[model samples]
Target: MISVESAIIGLFSFSIVLLALSFFKKDKYKELENQVENLTMIVMQENYQLKKKMKVLEEELLGNESYTVPLNERYETNGK
Candidate 1:
């Protein structure tokens, strides 16, 4: 048989414990958020670099292909 005053005190104590637990968890949450942000930035930078490398490779392939004369043209030039 709990009295009304005892119930109120028990509820108040439970709320205080929850508040303290939340405060402790908030710091860990912030640290995890920061780690995720850092990983995202790293991934973005790597993606940009890969795109840049692909562009350079595409340009080089196009340039190399443009320099090759046709087989007939090569034969005619060499025969002359």
Candidate 2:
């Protein structure tokens, strides 16, 4: 048989624990969001690096060619 004061105390403590749990859950969500943003940034950096590498490779390949330019490529290069 709980006294009135004991019941009130128990309920109050329960509510406090629930609020603490909610706060921790929100913090976890923020941590996960930060991790996702970091991963996205890493992927963007990798994509930029890959594009630069591919451009260099293309230039090297083109430089090795001694043949005359194609008609379309010549027109495009002249920007007309």
Candidate 3:
């Protein structure tokens, strides 16, 4: 029952609506992508900082000054 001209007009209207919707959402999508990238960079920096801190702590723990008591004297000094 639809005429060719009416069908063409309907198709054009649908295309315009879709284009408008896409245009409106484009900025929001770009903003989300940028936020994700920023968050990823922050996480990577935090991970690097944590790794560096852990290395320093490990080195400090393994230093000779940490074990002030000799192995044999430890049991004699402590009741445990």
Candidate 4:
């Protein structure tokens, strides 16, 4: 016994509810994206620091004379 006009109104109301739910989900997705960006920046900064520390260690090791012994001389000298 439902009238055509009433059915149309009910369908419109359901559409509006679905639209609002989609909008709310979009906002939540944006918030999660911001959190991920922040965490990525922190990880990148830590990675850069670690790379710098590794470079310094490599320089120190390369600067030592004992570590630079020529291959030919090593065989000529007694295994001291």
In order, the Cα lDDT scores of the candidates are 0.84, 0.84, 0.83, 0.83
Clashing pairs in 1: none
Model 3: residues >4 Å from true position, as ranges? Answer: 13-25, 64-80
- Flag the better candidate by lDDT, 1 or 3: 1
What's model 4's overall lDDT? 0.83
Best by TM-score: 1
Give one digit per residue, the lDDT tens place, for model 2 in 4-62.
99999999999999998887774667789999999999999999999999878877877
lDDT of 1 by residue, 1-80 (tens): 99999999999999999998887774767789999999999999999999999878866866654335766886787799
lDDT of 4 at 33: 95
TM-scores for all candidates: the values are 0.59, 0.49, 0.56, 0.57
Clash number by candidate, in order: 0, 0, 0, 0
- Itemize residue pairs with steric clashes in candidate 2: none
Q: Poorest 10 consecutive residues of model 1 by lDDT?
A: 62-71
Q: Flag the better candidate by lDDT, 2 or 4.
A: 2
Q: RMSD per prediction, one decimal? A: 7.8, 6.7, 6.7, 5.7
Pick by TM-score: 1 or 4, better one: 1
Question: Tens digit of lDDT per residue, candidate 3, span 18-78?
Answer: 9999877747677899999999999999999999998788669857543556667766766
